[model samples]
Target: MNDLHAVNTILADHLRIVLVGTQHPGNIGAAARAMKTMGLSKLVLVAPEKAPDRDTLAMAAGADDLVERASVFASLAEAVADCRWVLGATARNRRIQLEPLHPRDAAQRALVAAAAGPVALVFGRERTGLNNAELQLCHAAVHIPSDPAFSSLNLAAAVQVLSYELRCALLGDAGSAGQSRTPPPTAEVAAHAELEGLFAQLADTLDQIDFHKGRAPDSAMRKLRRLYLRANLDSADVRLLRGVLADTQRMARIAGEASVDKKIR
Candidate 1:
């Protein structure tokens, strides 16, 4: 079994910055600088209005390498397709059903998710912010705390704030060394293929009950998958869940047969 603490440490070093539909090249440059300060290097730009400019290079300062090697994508979906966990930065609360996490908390959770696969944090455009459709693509939303009365923050400032929090969380505070001496307990976690099979069984049962009659089944299933993935279920937990599902399906089948017999009688 892999050491859980070591796994978390490696994951912290492998985070990615994903900018979606960014309009200003300067903000992109500034974001790269902020990411570099936190030891993050991977960057993916999705459908930006302008490519990197001279002004951006000037603003980037010592982090020119990060900006120069940043990959550009034609769509947000393509940008985060390989990422196991995708987080979105948003100031205004859309009151969507998604769980809201602060930057530090998000980073910590992202570390755990990254242990299983790659992780990406998506920042929206400066003007209108992430639309509902774009937000749906992310697994979770992160909100930075600001003064309630006046909470407007510049795009680069937001990036800096999140990056700073991530750096601190990954590095920890003064007493962190003592805490790190004793590693956290590790559990056997479920594999991706096992989770996929569980989800398929659950979806089949839901379909039998017509739970998704009025809803988009694919979207609903995807949301359920996101929620389960966020839970980070261990192998034992997965088995327990699958057992419960099997019992539920058996009861449903028995109930259906009894109803049919009554109707015939």
Candidate 2:
């Protein structure tokens, strides 16, 4: 295949656009059309308010095939489970413990990640955007520098903006690109599922050891998650951490049992 065709195929297969809890069916269709124009085909929908309807088909026009091919999941976590890198697009100024990336910079990083494994750019619902929990699933937040004075961008328009940036990055026209983080050759960065599993084990282990004392573990878990995500750990790293957590849990259980035995004696 030619160079152009090769790059196109790689991007189409490796990079996905995920929409979480999209409210309007029409917006879904419009977003699909925007993706098609930028040579993107993979689309994942997470628990939309309603199934695609006539309005959706009307908006997609010639891009109806993308709508038909789109994968639907019950949750954003499930939708991005296989993706190695996930970036959440946010318009809200809400605080999240994730690294923020400009649209252009996000595109560059995404292209680099796509070489290692499937990468995703996640867009949340039209009305409210992604909640804190959903945003946390992403490794970074991608923000478009629209005018702060009038920053309301249409759902489809937002998709188009990111799509265009991705296309530019794919074509080697990304100007003043941000640092591109290449995944390690020894072991590519872990998929979303692996990272999530590590996070779960860490949380459970912390609980077993009474790391939180009486306080809720939510705040601490969030910080821990951010720390690990920033580490860009691969599958080996995840396995090693999980092993440590498992041992910690076992040790903690043994200590608790010994204490109980002493009290009984």
Candidate 3:
């Protein structure tokens, strides 16, 4: 096997392709075919409308093994529970702010994250794409550029495109002489679940301190989530933030009690 093939061989083990709320069973099969063609095997389905059925098997063609081995998840969070990094594949703009990257750049970022642990490439539903809340869970968004006249791409086709980009990123140019193939030093990034716990603590503390003022807080919280996720915080940072939030909660409660005592006096 060539150098490119060797790089893809290792990259495949560290990357996972996740489909969220996939409506068509055929699309699942086609996606599996796409991944298999690109030397990817870990396929995760998040709450598909239908499980891998006869259509999926038929559409998968020779990649039936991937379909059989695919794992089913009830939610996106559950699907990427263990992944240190998640890149959402989205075509449309939404209210939530996310770091957007071209397919190639996203592939590079994914490879770096995969050095540490599992990295997920998430695809949303066929019709509406990922919801705002779902997108917030992702560390970044991968956008595939196409003609402005008709930009809509098939779900499986999108998967194929991203998978190809990832492969290219791993392989490098054939002309380049003796490029390094060793994986970078993996960062000790906190997992999604740990970050989610910190976010919960943050929200409660913010509420205790009236941080939102009079306006609705969802938008602010979404932005904050994006900000912190982009920071790629490690376990130590997460622990420190959570501890600070706990202290903030306690201080706010004490202040409230003191005000009550003053009013009573």
Candidate 4:
């Protein structure tokens, strides 16, 4: 019990819960309440449709402090900009095959990431949930197992379930942990902001060469994002990839100019 308590305390510091495009202020308060119960205090809301009000405070019960301290962002990307690992809470399967993890399994993976840097668990809007673009930002998707007859879980309920699993994972009783094995050396994963910059550079380079060729670039970019995110690129990896993209762009521009000169000659 003592070991579990200590683990929970330390893990809490590295975990952050992000609510994206939240529609209800009450859900924010409820989520804060749930987080506090599970030893989590870092809460971020991205572009909430309704800011916290009197009802929100009332719903928070005794966890108003968490609600008060919660930071708000203008977008999902901005919310997780500094986080090294992002997990999206999604129940639906999209066209792209995202690695779907059960809540407990997700918690174990998240704990590993938290050991390296701040990790974010992102919950999408209450109505539509995370869109394709928002989900693309995440490295993986976490789904809470619910009865197929009535699987729809409330936003706050989903947060509570995931938080509970995380708490259990931290407590060292989660079955996902191996009993006897040497843990591998941890990698310093690049922050979301760095990955975002790399993605932008890649898009620009691809455009310069007309790689899309009238096809919708969103599909190709989304696939690329998922592929690289799964690779869990470290700082060195990001730098190397960005350098390649930069050189590609430079070469494309030079080739374009040479073609123009040849036409004139």
Candidate 5:
């Protein structure tokens, strides 16, 4: 296998970190240290309240490189834009209608997803945890197993736990040295524009069927789009759905013509 692909394979087996709305520079420093300790390097920061400075560098110690190299984004969407799978790290349930995974299970799933493309585990603010809006962006939520009575985890500690799980899942005891044959390149999925086009066609068909007349149909159509987007439909799937919409519109037109003929008779 090519060296670049092999290296990516190793990294792909691991998990990535994204700190959202982090409040303290020291915590960011410590989180970087924790990540490096487990052999993970990718760190993304989203709208951090404090800037990384001398204080952060001093705290990071040997992991200063990670702190310095971390990518900063103004928005969570930008931070996770390239990620194919996103996991939200939280102690309390955000209750945003997503399935919850324990840290270990989430790590395993993240490993698999990473092989296909970039994946991210997002950590929320030190104070309030991830909000419902942020949690909705994630494909799933991960809760570190802790005492229910008092389950708050320090930011660095949370990173350590999840990063450790990811490292173990990726490297095992022997480490990620001997793996061969790079996995197939992850196929590029359909873009949001393509999906939107399909949704528009679907809504047009629904209108032909009189499905959206009296009942504010836009809401229902939006929900349907959400459901499909969550499924991560590929190009082939989008084409198939478009074909189904075409057939539905054709049938609706025929039915309407037949009704007009009966009325005239």
Candidate 6:
């Protein structure tokens, strides 16, 4: 085996290709072929509307093994729970708040996070693409700057593009100035599930304190998520934040009891 291929096999193993709500069964097989061509093998299907049939196998061609071993999940969160990094691919400029990265840059970022744990590159349906809610689960958005005059990219094509970029990233030449690969020490970075737990605790803490008062909490939580995610929090960071939230919730309960006693008096 070539030295580069040998090294990339390990890094690529940590990366997963996730497809959500795919409409056509053939696209699933095509997507598998794309991943296989670029040395990617892990495929995750999330609640596809249709089932794979004969056409699916026909499209897979020589990459049937990837399609055969693909993991299926009911939800995106459950699918990516163990991942430390996730990048959602979309063409439309949705109302999502995540920082967008070009395919080449996104590949670099994904590879870096692969050092710590599993990383996911998510692609949504062919028509509607990923919604804001699903994008929230991702740390960043991957956008391909195709011609605006004709931007309707196929699901399998999009996977092929991103997979190619990942392969180029592994080769360490992505055509971006100042582009370099230095896999940072990811020893302490929290896993995807850990970050999700922190957010859940934060939401509960805010509710206990009535922090939103009369306003909607979703907007606030969204901004807070961006802030924390940008900070690239580690395991110790999550623990500290969770500890503070627990204390705040405890204080809120105590204050609520005191208010009731005063009202009674």
lDDT of 1: 0.75
lDDT of 2 by residue, 39-137 (tens): 999988999999999999999978999999999999999999988889999986665767778899889888878888889999988889999999989
lDDT by residue for model 5 (1-265), tens: 4875576456654456999998989999999999988878988899999899887887788899888889999987677766667788877754465567767767766776676667889999999878876776666678888988888799999999998888776654323322222221244655435656787798788888988777877567656754775677777888999999899998898999999999999
- Those runs of model 2 whose alpha carbons end farther than 4 Å from true positions after fitting are 179-187
- lDDT of model 2 at residue 258? 100
lDDT of every model, 2 decimals: 0.75, 0.88, 0.85, 0.86, 0.76, 0.87
TM-scores of the models, in the order given: 0.68, 0.95, 0.91, 0.93, 0.71, 0.94
After superposition, which runs of candidate 5 have C-alpha atoms over 4 Å from their true positions? 1-9, 12-14, 173-226, 235-265
What is the alpha-carbon lDDT of model 4 when measured against the actual structure? Answer: 0.86
State residue 99's C-alpha deviation in candidate 6, in Å: 0.5
Quote the positional error of residue 174 for candidate 2 in Å: 0.8
Order of all candidates by lDDT, from best down to worst?
2, 6, 4, 3, 5, 1
Candidate 2 structure, TM-score to reference: 0.95
What CA RMSD would candidate 5 show? 6.6
Taking the tens digit of each residue's C-alpha lDDT, what string does model 6 give over 83-183?
88888998877766788787878888888788787899999998998888899998888899999999888999999999999988887887552342322
In candidate 1, where is summed lDDT lowest over 10 consecutive residues?
A: 176-185
- Superposed Cα deviation of residue 189, candidate 6 (Å): 1.3
Model 3 steric clash total: 0
**Root-mean-square deviation of candidate 6:** 2.4
